[model samples]
Target: MKNLVNFKVAVKTRECLVQAIYQMLFNNDSVAKVIDQFKDEHKTKKVDFKMFSMSLRSINRNKKKIESILTSLEIKNSSMELIDKSILFFAINEMLFGNLDKPVAIDESLRLSKKFSSPESYKFINVSLDKFFKTLS
Candidate 1:
């Protein structure tokens, strides 16, 4: 059932779901703290803890890949804020791991930026994801 939920999210709204996960990770104050809190809070439940753990590990393991994608797109150290990095990470996760269609990934990134980030930030995300998509082809 948990796998079914993940599969549905991955198939139907992969980019948005990855963006949500990245947002959770990036804004958690600290990854370790977040994990600790999650463990403490959810340990009593009979939820799919293993899948959640795998998702967290996958995010952590792909951090460098995410950063590399942003750097390749010239996001720039000076311009890359936490939110910007989170967008990049989510985009890369969708592109590399989530099985989302390319245009869907790009469009969803743009939409997420427009909804959650500043106007200027949306432009940055648009250009970056556009460039990243071009490289994939």
Candidate 2:
């Protein structure tokens, strides 16, 4: 597997990635359209198409696993904010699907939580991931 840390794209770059995902999830856009829009918006903006493509593919490929993780964590119907779900979904994507190293995945997820979520969100994410991993053992 590739080094997931090396695969760690910037938060802003990931914001673009998630935007494409959100478009797909919320707007029902096709993958090609999402990629096209992403390219048009960031073609010359130093975005890593490789990372963006990989992350997008990861999310799409692991949708079921992500959903399972959310369900397993019992947050599927909880009243937690969307940001919380986003953080958990992202972490689960990395942990249960991405080929990145486990520590790298956790770190990247925490970084994302810090950047895009509330301060307490990281702790919540960390605990959730820890419990999820424990269930795997």
Tell me the alpha-carbon RMSD of every candidate: 6.1, 4.3
Candidate with best TM-score: 2
> Candidate 2 residues 95-132, lDDT tens each?
77666677766776677677777878888878878888
lDDT of 1 by residue, 12-59 (tens): 333333444555655754545545666676566544444445555566
TM-score, prediction 1: 0.64
| Backbone clashes in model 1, listed as residue pairs | none
Q: Give the runs in model 1 whose Cα sits over 4 Å from its true position.
A: 1-56
Spell out the clash pairs found in candidate 2: none
